[model samples]
Target: MTSTIRPSSVFLVSGGAKGITRECVIRIAQRHQCKFILLGRSAIVESEPDWAKDCFEESGLKKHIMEHLLSQGEKPTPMCVQKVFKKISSSREINNTLSRIKQAGGRAEYVSVDVTDALAVKEKVAPAVKRLGSITGVIHGAGNLADKLIEKKTEQDFETVYAAKVKGLENTLSYVDLNYLEYLVLFSSTAGFYGNIGQTDYAIANEILNKSAHLVKQKYPDCHVVAINWGPWESGMVSPELKKAFQERNIGIIPMEVGAQMLVNELDAANHTTAQVVVASPATPPARELDSKLRTYRIHRQLKLEDNPFFMDHVIAGYPVLPATCAMSWIINTCENLYPGYRLFSCTNFKVLKGIIFNEDLADEYILDLQEDSKNNDFNEITFSAKIWHKNLAKKNQYNFSGEFKLLREISPAPTYDFAKTPDGNKINENREVLIPNWEDNNFYQNGVGMLFHGLSFQGVKRFLTFGKERFTAECCWQGIEAKQQGQFPVQWFNPYAVDLSTHPLGIWLQHFYQESALPAQLDKYEQFARIPCNKDFYVSGKIKSKTDINLIVDFVIHDLEGKVFVRLFGSKFVRWFY
Candidate 1:
């Protein structure tokens, strides 16, 4: 609770143009507590910001995405194709940025400056003070670290890198009104302290930042100047040599988003974030890889999935054609076992496929909708014409979600097959067929994968839901925020199918509460069942399953393959009588 206090009103971010800085800028702006003045070498436009957005994607990220697209021979998008990376401020990108801020009801001012220049530095820093009144925090993200040897490096390279960083720091500090600013963050490299073999110039520059932290604090007691030392991230700098080195060392990629979050967490409380070297965690290629290898090492050697075509090297290669039914079957089999029940599919035109499989018969119709959702921005209110109860009708329903596990419908089990008694006294049985009801809904988008105890809605299954006071819906649905009620606690990825509670306090009261429960779902496929009818005043249909006891036998059977000219029919018939 104490951590929620918002920071000061204005934040000045240097190097707000790219990489980890981009995430930093975004995170700060997202807080909506401060007006962001983004200063960078790239283009930025504050007032009418169509152009400033050009700086959002870093050059390295752009290159990765472009290469990925171009390899497929796709027509390049304007954001990726043009050398706009060099264009700091364009009329268009700047205008877009400004427009976006205004639309969001936020304030932003952009100043493009070469932090490398001292006079330009004073020029950029002074005006910000005059406009914002008192600049409370300064994130000294400006940095330049060229990979080179100390002996082979030219004097210009050293001077250019150091002057820009060290001088930019001095120049930024000089212009500040000592009373207002509270914290200053400087981006330093871990190489400054640890020292890499080839990056001597980079190492020296980082060392300077590390060494100067104390001097900065003494000079400005009213504010904090922190030098943040970071390690190399895999998807960054796009360094081929570094990439090769990492591969050889078997180092994993450090996600920029993780590093950005850590930076924000530190920024919220202090001026400098006060660290010599914090490791900039959320370290990538987590130990899970090693754990996974160790877990399968024995079994892997015993039963190798790497048969001829299934070999490990076949990973990067795609199959051109199938030999027979075994060809597609092998792929399905491999993929199924590799990531069971997690494959995505597409069954429509001009859109992507996603979501978990529900039922094969149902999936035939559902995939088209999944494609539609992939193309549509808003997840709420996407409807369809359905033949419900043998009646053809058009119905509108809302379940705010995105991404289709187009494969999900294939996995949909008939909930009515095993009619367990609801905590309340109501009979829900498999023999009764139900009608799909329609209703109105309002939802908020959510983000993240952790199980939410409160907001509960199934992204892949929406047929059983309705709109009302206790409706299952997610708000702020992005990242992992699903508008669903409680989930299996502590687990990252969880989904509760048509889950409703009757005994809990929030259950009866019907308020949104988030918590995690590893409660297992009861899955059964019913050919037809009674409709769980939703009361107009509430969300879901109030139906309960009645219990029954019967004598039965369960048996596991083996099958035989009937081979003809080319194909084989594999099946078996077994009897398990019940009363």
Candidate 2:
């Protein structure tokens, strides 16, 4: 972890004299007491004019200017009054920024140089670096906006917005020596990353800055080069009408203090891998394009015992086998990542074709292949098929897992189905003997104490509420260690440990009624109505739908304390496991 800024660091900042950038400059000066060479296009008045010197307020200055115009025999047009007001106000703002930085125990100097002019930038910045010392950091925040659709925009309109960001960055970096630089912060906009409707030129210019940041970071591996894609801030740029519209649409506006602190935090952070990032509230509109092109993606993975300590708890018959729920987690998490704005609604036809057993002859790596099947743009739904396999010289396709996943743009409402009570409203069949485990040991899944073989991590059955021929319910809690619990994979949408416990009732019923233990074979469907509750007591109810000599099919439902169904596993088939 390296400190990015020091008291002796010299930062050349563009567009740092006003607006959000000025706040960041003031904060940096306060924290590090570093010197700043602030650049801007506006030229400030060294002193107020004689007649307007007495006026401090904006309205008073305007009145004096109007009276002075009348005495000089000139027309005081509305446009003339506004033009003078802007100059005086801008000069006052620049002077205040400089004074604030100095008050924060930092030295500062203002340079009126247009960043878009490469020769002028070189002429102004080279002399400042020579006198102050070698440059250590650069904050490029200069930008202009020409908000218009491409059809209505003129060529000059595009250049006016594009020159300030793209050309300005190129001109500023040309004279600085990158070998000794420690930080490079580029102020980009969310309109560039997630394109806005009327900001084509601005988006294009800022995106170039983003790509340039990545390129520079690769060359200077030690420098913290980050391009922040900031959303709209509470500043003079956002008009009242625009602010009202943003509120109506539930979009977020960044406050001035918060946005400034984010810049300082980014510089102070020790992470060097993050080169481009977005800094915005969660309400920022994401880029959603209904791309229907068919695509196939492949990702490779390798599993080892040393990397996955949690697998030690799941050993069956002297070997650690990958759990079916964890395998499903891989497909669900990968699909969600491939499509940014969609979540896994349900997974169907999920089967464990071959369980990945951790043995001496395990393959070096496995490949996960995913292919898009269909997409419905109207409903914002998509379907894809995925399989985990390893190439073998003798075999053609050795798939370890396969499933079809459906993703939805929004989560479905929590289902209202009671799994606790029987549908026919019949009392429990008490004639059938109830099988209960000893409370002292709580060893339902221990190696020899119980029929099933599972270690402490998978032992989630705390106590049984009811056990009968037709239905059985049990209280369960997540007892597994959270750190690196999913073996080689990580938990994403839902906890696999909790999901694994939901199926335990099915296995328990088999051992109680038929004197046999079963393992999950395949799943007919898994629908997530709501998120599973953690750090609290939840219940799982399993009702036997059908049974045969070879297998048993059951329906398992997990619900919260209020008896609202959160997850439903329909037609879960399990085959008897013989020891």
Candidate 3:
């Protein structure tokens, strides 16, 4: 359907005071003398202060202001810096934008309201509607980014990122009369379409917008509901470092003028067709090939124990630490992305050099470095040494884990064997007088071990067979919740959650012998013979090889009810955390 905007049409733009929205308003106003209502969170000042004006025109004003704050024994935080700049800078920007719109023969007004607050949005829009007549079109451009890995995101971080686009749209949609609304445009991002490495929350938020646009279009067939999944644009949002990173991946940044023009073009082509469109520059090959010997990728993450409540179940000694299996899954997933059509077969010489402890307030950044074997000649088979290091802003990078991993094009079938028929050499009967009837009744795991939290189906231990402190065996059932949660297309062999459950006997032994919980610090060798299905009961057996003041070395074998050994971990060391 062809559509045209009248000179007297009322247009509402969220996040309109600055950035892309401001640019769009200026461009649209130049075309027609429309009535525009701009909504933003920042308040407009009556007049720009002298210092603010000087700061806007002068080059060294920001540095001088920061230095002055420091001299007064005040910390110059992000909030403080924004406060100083907004006092003059933001007001000047809004005023200049409004002045330009008026000069182009358009009438514009700004309203200060948090778009996430439904009542506040309703209150602001009602007055604008009464004054400018019924709202005809809307451009929902409000969004925020909290770029953190899934493991590092907090509940607050998720809420903050989600509220900008998802909740903001919900609040505005509640006030708009969609029956007569001419157009509804949403500014989405590529992160939602192709998942980014460290933008879990942001991707979720934008994907919601894209889906909502389609649903809204179905209801209001005449109204143009379009969600544009845009790539990186040269704006305040794109940092220099981020631009360089995107460049390295052969992704081009859209120019501001080009992006603004694309928005107008999409609106003009209002056919009520194509609910979502991706506007991105053509990809190009990297300027230089990465070194075959070494390659490294860095990611910043803010891990919070409370973000994913299930993670709290894997606690050790009153502290939450990431399980080794989870770390391995991350590494394997990364490799799969780098090399398509290949999967990780097994990891030899696997080791957890250090435990990653979750901090309540601060998030940890990590660097994954890969070293390729120059001697190997096989093109299909790749052998590489992988190391994961936690970046310490103040101190040196702390080593977390290191191992040798192998990727294969395809895996062989599982060999047949029956583990249930094997004789139990150190079995402790459940009915025995000395052994505890219920595994949870044992004080050793309940009181001493912090990692074994209740309600965590994947890490639940059904029964424990203790043959003194030197050896132990446990039975664990796969609850099948992990597969449902992960939603993996083709099920993977050696489920990471299953691997974690199978290794619980080691933690139990550590508490039994030392009266203190320990973390898996090092694994000298781990070999996976075959893939284990998630819908099966498994047995874990561990034998303590040696013990020291701060470390315990153990060998573990994980097998199914059919007596088939799926994986074997030898010379795995558990280290005590004194802190």
Candidate 4:
């Protein structure tokens, strides 16, 4: 980090002579005693004219101006009086700001130029830079407001609002020397971050400033550049009706003093990595909802070990294979993002037709296709079928994974386990004899002689309780992998590592009895009753319903010691490599 401000710093500030920007400029002068070249559209006079000078109050002054206009045989309309008053007020404010800055031990020069005019800006700014020395920083706070609904807005309205913020910054940046620049502060608005009614043009302008900050920072990594998305304040463009509307909607207003001080402190701060920030009130409402209509959608993604580091520890037979659970996670995460308020409750018919192997670059890109099943959606339940596809070396499209996901507006209550029944609707036979395997040496997941070949992060089996040809039960705990250090594969909506570990009993049983390596083939259904705690021990019971020469069908119930069910996997099928 490097310091952003100094006593000798020179700043070029637009719209720094009035309203919110004026407050910020005064604070910067008080803190650093820096010199400024302030730009505005209003022309300034050195002294007020004698006709309206004697009236001290605003009402008295307006009356005096109207009277003087009438004496000159001119009609004194309301709009004419207002126009003259605005010009006079603007000049007085600019003069007062310059006097205040001087009293605060800083120097300022006011340049009257419309920033939207590129030629005027260049001519005025170049002369100011020649007189004041090289520029060091810039504060872009110029903007206009033309509030109208999109249907009622004209092209002129859009241009007026857009040019003040976007074109003004562009014109000003043409004159500054980036080699000498240390900080760039862009004053955006919250309307751009979260859309507000009747501010489409205003939002578009501010949003451009937000994106331009990032582009500039990318080119100048050493500069402290930031775009503040400020919310509505107590003054400065806040009308009385608008303020009342904000209060009714529970949106907080930023105080003038607090907001101005925040700007000065940021210039003096020592951070440069952050390119954009939001200095708005927290009570703002969320953005508009996305369309919930059922439709087919496709998403594309590139796969590599560098992007998914968790796969480095999920190797099989000297090659990294994508875990079946991760494929399911990709589907659920995508589906959840598609619909804003819906949550995934269950999945059905999830099958891995082909496993993705990272040896010799089998594939680098994949596409996920999701189609909504509108016929089955009823009573607040929505369902979608999803598939992951890739092209083989022969350039033919092939699918690797497929599943059906169910979503609901509200999650159902957590389910309770029945000790008398199995997960696949079968009666439990408690008196059957079972074999308890001895894994005290902890070689179950080790290489070569071990039953499984998972690396450090994937080996989460603490111990096994019993094993049999027909059934088995185990006590397993998470391996406590530092998922944060591994990056994006941490446990999010569901714990994939824990579910992967639960399938190990079948793998171990197949290897121990038949001398055949087993891999998951298809999952008929999976329902989550509650989130599985990764730090605590849990129990897994697997029942082999039937076995053929090529495959085995099994059911699983995962629960705690007190039989509180966390998840159920029914009609899962595993097969050998030959199948």
Candidate 5:
């Protein structure tokens, strides 16, 4: 449907004296000789105002006024400064805007009306409609921002912010005749669309406007109702500190002229029946930025027992479960895809929330959501709260695993560590008394760690060394089977198979100490100090830090023949299994 308004149409705009509303009025007036009734809370003054020429020109005036207020021994708080600015400059601003509209060949008038008050809005709007004829368009741009972290916001702050947008739109709707209205535009914000850090109240208020617009459109089909979710504009509303914050996040501020032009184009086209439309520039440096607040990346894989029949060999309690190491590998693979040059430096708070069980009848879909955290650029750290959920499961508990991962530049310096040594200042030799001699020659396929031949290709331990009651050391070799199986060499810092094999000593330590089989339940801190070679021998050493009835806390490291550490698992944990 064509949603066009004539030049002689009557338009009523709220918060119309300054900022975005003023810019819209100026743009519309330049194209159409419409009658505009500008509504604002500040009373109009008859004085010629020099500051009215430019919105930012009042900075010097505000500084002078603040100095005078201070010289009079008064505290110049934000409220005090605003009250003084409004008293001295509000009238000139209103008068100047009206003059500009008239010069653009549009008839204009200003009225001081509290739009949140239904009776006041009706009282003012009724007279304007009677004087200027039926209202053709209404722009509800009135909004107040009480930006505070949700925890710090009080009841009064929420009410104040809500009054201008939510309450003001309600009052305006009550007075305006929707049947005669050709356009009803609500200026919403991106805060409501995607949310911002300290804009809880503002987000709620604008979201209400967006939903209300949809409801209004159902009743007034002919009248175009739209809520434009706008980003921060380069205006007085955005402070320098706020601008810098947005810049750091790669969020671009909408230019004043560009925003004004968008408003005109939307109203002129009149083809928008969707009720909600977003008007904002794409995020700068889009590579690292996410389109949504919570980014979910997904992968679907059918667990076929026939295709990889060896997976059935790693069953626990008769149920086939994906290995924890493979899960970590999948997450690392995703991170590598999202951030090409960055590598996983450390993973902490890793927990097996629930075990994923496979079914032959249905294919399983896995979901990975990486929530962006407050970044610390000084450390070159990009932290994310990562989760892997089983999407095909009908059970209420869908999360298979959850953890926090940090990615750093591959060029970052490796961590330095002093491995435990002997009193003679030489590396500790494998104690022959406790060592398992000819471990590789034993029937590992029948009597070994739970991993079978196919699993062993990735998780086979070659030798055991320095075995003791609470501490042990062992050697594992990466066969590069992952490269052969997948037909491509993995460039990840830590080989998943090699890393998993290194943890086998922890299971041996658990069997020797607790006399039971155990599985890795949680990993607190896993750090990769350097990249491991594809097909090379690596040493793993671990020591028990503490032991509970069911859990053992251990620290382990994976290093090369030269004793250069490749990966370290600190504050690691294993849970003893009964079945």
Candidate 6:
């Protein structure tokens, strides 16, 4: 709260050229008629405070009086300088700021210097002592008050406010010369004492400066160091809404000058005893006297709730885990034909969850779901048949598994679509099998149309449908001419054909699509898994038809604990079963 720093007799006012700090500087300087050094971010070499001009412009101003007094003119008071600054602030255009100052008869000058740099302050600011003949006080009024919460605050945001205030204060204290510096006035705020709601971090940073106020005062005995806890004032920082709001509270608005004057008034007493003072338009109530419910900053500390052991247990065990799994299931199985809210794989959530049996210590809140799903009710027992492998399961050593199949307790609804190929007029070709040439373009387009146009039938894959148009398509059968998928009765037109599918991608891509995502394990007896077209078009079976006839990949999803998924599949026209 030290308003000014005195060197010899002149007082160095930090941020003395603008804002509430300006008035504080002028009032103290003119009152004592002591020379002053006003500081700003920019340089006075380019401009000087308008008071310097008005002093030389008007007839009765200070400079005019000094020169003409002996010869006989009257002397104007310090009020002559105040008019210049007021007009500049109200000027409609920035270009007229200096002109308005001149019209009102004053001068404005600034010396280039970054106030935050201590070395710069010691050089540019301390030298003002000799230039002005003496320095009396310094007001550390240059600071900021931005609003941001801790959670949202970033590194740059916190640095901006800290640099202007904390750095500015550190710069000022470096020059507390007893013979020259008499007062140290810092424009602190209530935020420093009681952390602001949205500015907890900012307030904590300011407290670092506040806590050292006494030490600063003790170090500089001649310098009166005052810490002002400023409240909402009608300044650039105050919103229009706040101005109107505070007006209704019957509290008086301090003209920036009054707030400045408060600092100046306290500067005179920068002694060993009086180190801190709060400057606010409306005094706050005693600490801890306010209602706890009304306090927003103490939310974490003021939490109140009844002890619910079950709720606590749920939190520890992760209550929303099941819900998250259910969401994923719904997204992956959107086309499942179930009731509005009920889904097919939805029950799978309970199945896997049964694996994680909570101890007896599991909370009642979690136990509430026991009756919800009868299958999940008995958490003590949840197991499925392990996968068994044969000595030579597949042509490859790595790919194979055997599972004891479990029959469904009840059959679900029938499928939504039917396929009929034998009739006279049907979309399906009368031939049970069809094969395109190994280099046929028609084969690629028909199979890749879904992949290239709307997108892949699986996980939205964009494949080489055109293959650079350099004859991208082809057809190759898995078996000999006589080994094509055969029908129950020989119909001349009802023969399945083969298209060259060699270039097709054979890989795994996790996708959400209805159908058997993979060929039935790997055919152990045959070197490769075979996809044979059945006589019945759309009958549900382990057999998959992937040629020009059905236009499908080895797509299937086994409804078992062990899952094998695939899409964009390829196989042969003739495949045999291992009976």
Q: Which residue runs does candidate 1 get wrong by more than 4 Å?
A: 1-8, 44-85, 88-106, 218-222, 234-236, 250-252, 270-273, 280-579
**Which regions of candidate 6 fall more than 4 Å away from where they truly are?**
1-8, 42-109, 176-180, 244-252, 269-272, 281-579
My TM-score estimates for the predictions, one after another, are: 0.40, 0.61, 0.50, 0.55, 0.52, 0.37
Candidate 2: tens digits of C-alpha lDDT, residues 1-579: 364577789999999999989999999998889989999999999888888776779888999889888988989998888788888889999999999999999888889999999989888877777777788899999988778889999999999999999999988888688887888999998778877767899989989989999999998988889999998899946778767756744568899988888888888887768899998643333326668787899989888888877788778788988888888887788888777667788889888888888886467888889999998889888898999998655656688888899988777788776554332212323432233543234446654432346666666776566677888777788755766665556655656768887887666667656778777888999988777766677888888898888888988889875678878898888887887
lDDT of 6 by residue, 1-579 (tens): 434333235545566566566555556654444455566664222354444453433444445434433344434445543454334332212223234333433332233456678888788765555555544555666665557667887888787778777887777667665555655566666667754556665576567667667777777665566667676666746678656645644335677767656655665543436666666543222222112121111000110112211112112123311111221222222211111112222122111112111344222221110111122212221112212111222332221122111112122332232222222211212332222233142233343221111111111111221111111211122232222211111211111111112212221110112211221222111111112222211111122334233233242211111111111122322212111
TM-score of 5: 0.52
- Cα lDDT of model 5 by residue, 1-579, tens digit: 566767679888999988888998889998877888889998765553543334455777677667877888998887898887777677877877998999988888788999988888888777777777777888999988788989999999999899999999888777777877888999999888877778889999999999998998998888888999998899947889888878765578889998999988888773676899987643322135333344545555444555544355357666666667667876776775676446688899898876666655233556777776635545555667878876443544377788988887534555554554332211233443233432334233345543232254455566555666667666677666534343222435556666766777666555545557667789999888777666677777887899888877889887765677788898877777775
Candidate 1 lDDT over residue span 1-579, tens digit each: 122223346667777645667566666555554566767776543353233333455665456546656777986697555654444334344445545544544566778888767788777767866786566667777777665767788988888778767887777767666555666777887667666666677777778887777666677655656677776665446488776765543445567777777676776664443445546432222111111121110001111222222122111112211111111122222222333322222111111112111122111121112112221113211211111111112433321112212222132222321221122211213522121111122111133122113223222112222222322211111112222211111111111121221111112112222222121111111111111222211122322122113211111110111101111111111111111
Ranking by lDDT: 2, 4, 5, 3, 1, 6
The prediction achieving the highest lDDT against the true structure is 2
Record all residue pairs in model 3 with backbone atoms less than 3 Å apart, i.e. clashing.
152-302, 152-303, 315-451, 418-562, 418-563, 419-562, 419-563
lDDT values for all models = 0.40, 0.80, 0.71, 0.80, 0.73, 0.38
Expressed as tens digits, the lDDT of each residue in 50-169 for candidate 4 is: 986756688988998899889889999999999988888889889999999999988889999999999999888888778776789899989899898899999999999999999999
- Could you tell me which 10 consecutive residues in candidate 3 have the lowest summed lDDT? 282-291
For residue 397, what is the lDDT in candidate 3?
73
Q: Pairing residues by index, what is the TM-score of model 4?
A: 0.55
Residue-level lDDT for 72 in candidate 6: 49
Query: What is the C-alpha lDDT profile of model 3 across 1-579, one tens digit per residue?
Result: 445778878888889879887888887888767878899888888865444445554336566667767978999886786677665567778888899899988888888899999999988778878888888888898888777778999999999989999999988888878888888999898888876767888888899999999998898878888999989988847779889978866578888888888787887774658899988743322323223554555444445555444456665556666767767766776766665445576687778777676755233566677766532224455666788787565677777778888765545554544333322333445453124333445443464344344235455566664345566666667666644344321235446777777766666555544556556777777767766556566777777899888887888877765556778788887776553
TM for candidate 3 is: 0.50
Q: Which is the leading candidate under TM-score?
A: 2
